[model samples]
Target: MARALNDGPGRECPPALPFVLAVGVTGHRKDALPADSLLTLHDRLATVLKALTEQAAAVQEANQSFFSDAPPRLLFVSPLADGADQIAAEIALRLGFELHAVLPFDRGRYRADMSDEDGRVRFDALLSRATCVLELSGESDHHLESYVMAGRATVAHCDLLIAVWDGLPPRGRGGTGEVVRLAHDRATPTIHVPVAASDELKIRWSAFDPAVVTHAEDQANVRTFGEEELGAVLTAVLSPPPDEREREFIHMFQGECRRKLRTRIEYPLLLAATGVARLRRHHWRPEIGAVRTHEEWQTYCDACHKVAAVTTPIASLQSWYEWADTLASDYAQSYRSGHVFNFVLAAFAVLLALTTLVLPDAKKILAVAEFAAILAILLNTQIGVRRQWHRRWLDYRQLAERLRPMRSLKLLGLAAPDPPGTAANPTFGRWVDWYAAVVWRGMGCPSGAIDGDRLKAMASTIAEHELAPQVAYNKSVANQAERLDHRLEIVGLTLFTTALLGCVVLLLGFAFAPHWVKANSNWFTLLSAGLPAIGTAIFGIRVQGDYVGSAVRSEQTARVLEQIADRLTRNSSNLSRAGDLVEEAARAMHADLDEWRLLNQQHDLSVG
Candidate 1:
């Protein structure tokens, strides 16, 4: 199938996450500067921006090695007030970097802040040219709060802060120093472009000290930077080495599993998805149209549109796979730990029995070992409960199954389930659903309607590659489960039979060999008590494993999936019928998974 589609007026498939350098500005107003200093400051601003742009380009080139699909973009974010903000925006535009404007209030209310008539026209022009304009909504009565938040917001969004100041304390609310202070708190690197009210054009640069203990200390201990350090600083702040934490997050989502063509490229295709944590959007392809028109595009020139794009459908699928694999691995490890402890405890009980009946040479003091073993078992149970290993295993497995069919539906470009409520749904399930929603929304739908040919292709693909294999897998699982159940039954029955035989022996000894039974009362008593305990413990272990119940559920799931597979295969030739069949099968699989979870829920960690 032809994957490439023509790009036009509609929404473009967003590009991968681009290397964006968001620079925020805070500085002296025109009123604060001397009349003679204005032009020099403007020229100085232009020089710094030009240098930064070049530095950013180099950083982008280096980043391209890892994030191949992401292009580099330089964006200056500011609220275009009379002096430094307007100057910086104009300089950034002149340098071909994008501008993003943030306002504390509406443009009409904000226009009043500009005393310069010429500055007002310039502000409007700059605002119009901005790639994105973020207008914060709040009560206008508290002007200071609005101002402070806007500064905070700008600082929050920016990678670097550009302070065009003389290192003076802020004169009022949300002043240059205040914003700079906020930036310092966040450890966001700031470039201090010292501008005085003098006509003498001595341009010097400095940066905030991240290690400074206090704002006062930071202000006092500013590190002066020469031209030689400029490139290094930009590289450090903009394209620093990827962190270990980020690598761990990525690794968590990557797993070896059977995947569709889309899922095979899940990691790299992550470029096509964007979002902020739970909130996300995805771009299905890179060649689609821009999200905004040219006019609207101007408002977002500085925005990295791809950042909010949805996760790749394949990637979402991969996440579920990874989660499932992790759950299985965790469950197996937990089960093994529990089983070992139980076995050791059982051995201790048997040893105590032997001490009373078979080993007359040993003193009762040896029974202390049995008591210690019993204590160990109690401690193990407590530890397991505290860790919630069993609960986590069940939860993650349920989560995995919930997301299982989403990948297939996403691949086929079908509608996905709605995002689950965090309050109502299980924590893992809610997150899974939220992630799927983000991918679904970001992907939107295919541009044109699904025609017969597309339907036929989908059906053929699912039938040959999906349905046939799924049916076989389910059948195999059912067979394994049945065998396991049979094995469990045999083990349980043998324990009971041994206990029964011991009872018969004890009865016969009591009836026929009364004198012998009297001489060996302790031995007979030990056998009578220990046999039932051992038998009961064995039965408890079998029940705890839920081997019987699990086999039953697996058998049911396998049968339903097999039936659905048959329907899909039979209707593969008919496009309409095949589409419905595929959807039905996917839903049926999901339903079966939910049913299996419910069945598991019925069986807790029972030793009774």
Candidate 2:
């Protein structure tokens, strides 16, 4: 069928391929300068150049790897507005790329508007340094002129606009509409950079629950322009013969499960079918996509997801494969650590439980350590489970996107290993790793180690990820976990305090507590007090279930992060094209409390 269509007349695919001919970055407050207050302009200027060089190299690498071997030429365009522009220009200059500084027509007046003495000096330096300056409109307002000039450069000169917009759409300034309007007006492509200004890590993983992305997939008219191309793809995927390796492996697993065509990619093939069964068995696909109008694609995605859920088993096999291969040392370390921690907790718990039965000493410290260790195991388990789920979705999402012709899923990992002296996950890693290294190992660190009182103020709102519906919807498992965690924290704190107080009360009763009354006047008084204490103990014990705990859902977070990162990865090929869907979803999720009501203005006006 596909062969027939490929040979069809008037419907031939183009061989020219997609390309980004130029790069233009523009933003107010020199958005590319990394949001620092301590740095001088000179210090920042140096950093920005380095940043552009590295980023451009990354861009070039992606282009070379994916689209073509011929390295794309860099066309640096900015107003040269003192910081990012100056750096971009200088970097381009040093890299021997063409620098087209699209300046405002009234560059003199724009220069005049600078009230800051340092800024004026820096601007003067930037202007002098630029390769060439093209003019914007002749306007009185420098702010207005710079923006207009930027708009013009995007339309008149640049092929692609790299908007270093700090991931925010300000009032009439950095909005997508501004870019779209200009792009439409001039018919140029634009790419917004830095993903989002507020995103510290510059990437995040989203739970690619097959169901969620399925709905998105259904809605996508990847065949915006028809079925001939899509049908060709569908036939290729659905009718392809299974690989020989898959066939041999399938017979090994179960002779009858083998099909003539299925033997080729046996591992992934059976794994997908088996994985689907497992995910369903666990009821992990929490949210279902709406029943679709397109039944064929829907069934296809479902089958694909089921087949891919085997990704967990596949990843486990891969993990084992790595262990068997060169990563043997790393795997050995992981296994050893796992066993050591398990042994330590099991021993500690046994000792603590024994002491609880017989000891009259402050042997309770043993229990604290045991409980903390248990919590760590549980948290790590949750994180693992979440990651497993993400791996499943990621494998399929890649296949889905590739098949859909949405965009290619290229990445940094395939080409290069991490450099020395950097943590794997940097932004959240510092805090997460610090806790793992210091606090999470055992309970009760030094007095200096904890700021218990400081945590009290923020206790009610512990970075409410649940309130963000996208996170909640996409990562229901993780959201429940985060909620359970927060609840457990309260429970853990209460129980620890209660246990301490109980020991103290027992101690005081044995000695000084007799002061209030000739306390042993009646056994009834002691019984009455003991009854309430027992009740409190029971309540605390019940609350501890919250700490017995929810899974970490880290995989869900990682999957979601991959989706976010994938957006950036796609842009390296088509530098001017904007993927606003991700930006909107992210902003909608990340928006704090204040933006909601202001953002929902029409509702109240309509209701009132």
Candidate 3:
């Protein structure tokens, strides 16, 4: 039976969130209220200024990373008036990030009204860099806002919007509020750094999807498919047919599947050699031949989903897709949060180390203040790092290790581990391969698109929720282990050297002191003091190192997990369409399963 996408419920992909950056221009506003006290204005200005500086720096970093370092790339920015805008422009110039303006009024008029000398310069500098600076010159009403809104709406389609807010209520000058509101309307993650919350910054980065972005926009993007609609679609593909000729067509289709299996495994590869989104450019494949009508296919799809619901508590393939989508959303948030947290903590650790150094007898004080700062930062960091490792990387690793064709692992005498909690999906590698294969066939992936790299990226989506706690636990062990090992290495070296230095000091004390003093010198006393300190140092180093070794083992385990995930991802995508086609062909030909298995097994595909 032949099936077309028209014969089945169409899988949906989320739309892109536009990257809009709203920069708050700093400096004095001309119209300060008569009621406003100088102190209050100064306080507000101080808070706002601090926030702008931070937001600008974060924006610059994000600009560099998003466009150059990762996917869902960013190119343009939406900035408003304020110091934040200046910072944003500075970043754009350095990184080559594009800028566009949604002006509230005529630029010349706005400039004429502004009193501050630097303010005009700041505004002019920002204007010079914009790709397109659109004016909000409508009637003084909501629709007038549409000029900018329309501009934003156009940008929102590209993916990502950055809104720099005062973190206060929307009473401030300029349209930072509107920028944020519009971005939310588009289901975009707003990188909000409140003007007052200068010391801390929170980044909400989602790859795509409304939940991560907002309520209204999400509603606009995701379409809910009912059973009737699905049934009508699936009715086209089935075994029973209208005529013998149609039955003959089905036979031909089945024959095609057979030939496809015996020969090369094609499909599942998304070749950028053609280019990204090239599938949209390619001609559609011939429809699946089957006796089932579109309605019947729909019925089967819905029924299968309904039955799936009962069989699996979460129930239904549709639900699973939804779950996967949700997982993708949450995954992005968790990943970003974990990373940001680590980066901040690491920074804190460095700062703390530096601060402790300035204190009198800091080493003695390090045991007190340094320990608390170090412990807190390290603990939090370890927890966050481990969480990230488990959520995606570890699962991918384990799957890869399990899924790799046996001979490759055997060559190194390496066998995949049945990770402690994955009994339910013993054949994770196979399952992932199956999922990828289905995606491949539907997508018309030609080749290389479904390689090792693709598989690893795909498996990142498969990180289970249960894995979270375990990942954290694993990371904690890893942190302690790493800390211990590092401490050991540094301390061991430090102590041995210190001991040797102490003997030298003992000799030097005599030489440095006068001969009379040396004769009456408390040489024995100095030796006693120095020797004890050296012993203490050595003892502490050894003790710390020994305890940390266990943590190191955990770290080692984490690395192994990462490797396994990479392999699983690679194997899964490679096997996707081709793997299914091969098995189907073998089944139709009635070839020996054992021989087929052996033939597949005997050839080490890793070399290729």
Candidate 4:
């Protein structure tokens, strides 16, 4: 009859895919690359970009089902400086790739670096065509730090870097060589195009060196990669790594749920304290539209903010899972503790009654104590019902489980619409809709088709990472529920057997030896009443726990998930079929939630 302290299942969210591949550009000024060579670099860069577009199209074709409403795009980002950046941007634009400019400073001052009138005109035209321009604010254009900031921003967002250089050290800060070194240190992949050696006199000054250091001969030399090598590098950079795996949702659930639950429990206590303080002050009218003191206004604002915090959708999947899990676990613990105390009190009361009947003296005192015990039991039950701890526990648990599958589905790029064809607006306050919307927005439609090799890798990931763990967890839950169910029935029946035996003994003593019966009549009476009373309390505890019903429901859910796991693990299952199986599992999970909700509603308990 002790309250169950079993831990419930935790939830997890699926990891998201990278939405775009950003390519960054860094190289020398226009003077370093002759006009003829600059045109050659432009044509070669354009050809490479066109081939990349085709590769994206091929990926899109293979993984048609994985995409969201808006397909992912290939983004080419640059500082749009006078030489290499401008050439790359012009080529990328022609190939239908997005061009994002990360400027060192505002255009007016940055334009001063162009020097030539023709270069300034081209810079303005390219800036107009850019999809996005990120200007470094609060920095003077006159400073070299501004240019460095732009270079750092470009590297930060891009997956690959293209450098056009003459293998020379930087003449000043924010030069091509310095940017290339940064890219190398960060392990960003780069394709360097060599420039022709210049015969002009060079002014070399190194702050680190004692005297001005000059190169005996220019290091600039040609060693260009073939078309095949460039294509292979581009493919490697753009494609998602086959081995990269997303983190599981349950791990996050376990961590986050505790914090969320604590906040929930504190809210009511805080609100109650606030209410009583105002009540103590006679005729304190804290009307919404009325003028108030600073303290009153602050309290009002704080209350509103707390309400918003609870009701709003938690943006991160990990955060959302934690809150729901914490709410469920805390409420469940409270519900269990109340039932345990009530069960113990009820049984003790019955024992006290039997003692009062058989005792030679202080019978009235013993009876009063027994009555007090019963009153305590009833009071505890009333308090539990008024607080609605059991109901809230069930509701929060339902929400948590429903969200778990969504994390996996979204991560695998196989999530289906709830009740297919229904548009789920995630902003909806209802947890289900809100969670669905958040996941959908988080994992937007990917336009690139996944090749067969990538598709196979995804299938293996689903089987090992998601389906395998879920299968094990559900099976364990089912087994635990069944064991609890069996124990409850056994205990309930044993109590009834004890009561029946006590009745048999009482009847036999009264029927066969009349003289002996009179001498021990009090004992017989005690046995007849107290044993049955204890048995009745045992039955009541069993009814409250609903162990049998829970066991059956858990077993059904476990079986459903197990079947889905089988489908997912089959060697012949293609990516499309795996997607279908995942979708089926999601449906099954939701169905389980609906069933639990109905059961909790039907068995709603009240003090009356």
Give the candidate number with the greatest TM-score. Answer: 4
After aligning candidate 1 to the native by TM-score, how far in Å is the CA of 538 from where it should be? 2.3
Residue-level lDDT of model 2, residues 1-608, one tens digit each, is 22233234654321111122345555445433554532443343334434544554554344331222334445565666655455455555666555655554446766765646666786777667655554433345445534653554443334334444444434575343364345423323233334333332111111112123222112221222122332232222111123444323212211111011211121122223323212221121111211121232344334333322111111221221221221122222232233333333444454454554344365577567668866766664454344332222222222222121111100000011111112221111111111111111111100110012222211111112111322443455455445544543454456456656755665677686665435443333333343344444333322322212223333344356445444533443221122232332233332321132133222210100
Total backbone collisions for each predicted model: 14, 28, 50, 12
Cand. 1 Cα-lDDT: 0.55
Ranking by TM-score: 4, 1, 2, 3
The RMSD (Cα, Å) of candidate 3 is: 30.9
How displaced is residue 591 in candidate 4, in Å?
1.1
Model 1 agreement with the true structure over 495-543: per-residue lDDT tens digits: 5677678778778988999898788877766766665566565555555
lDDT of 3 by residue, 1-608 (tens): 22231133542322111222232222123233222333444344344333433443444344331111222222344333444544544554455445555454446655554447676887787778665554433223343343343334223322333334444433432355555554444333344444443323333322223133233223333222223322221121111223454344222222222011111111111111212223221112212211122333244335423322111111122222332333233333333333333333444444445544344366566556656755665665566455442233222332222222211111111111111112222111232232312221111101111223333333332211112223454577566446544544564467457657756666786678657445643444444444444445334333422435445545554454444444443444432222222223222212221222333232211101
- Any idea what lDDT model 3 has? 0.35
How well does model 4 score by local distance difference test?
0.54
lDDT score of residue 505 within candidate 2: 63
The 10 consecutive residues of candidate 4 with the worst lDDT sum are 201-210
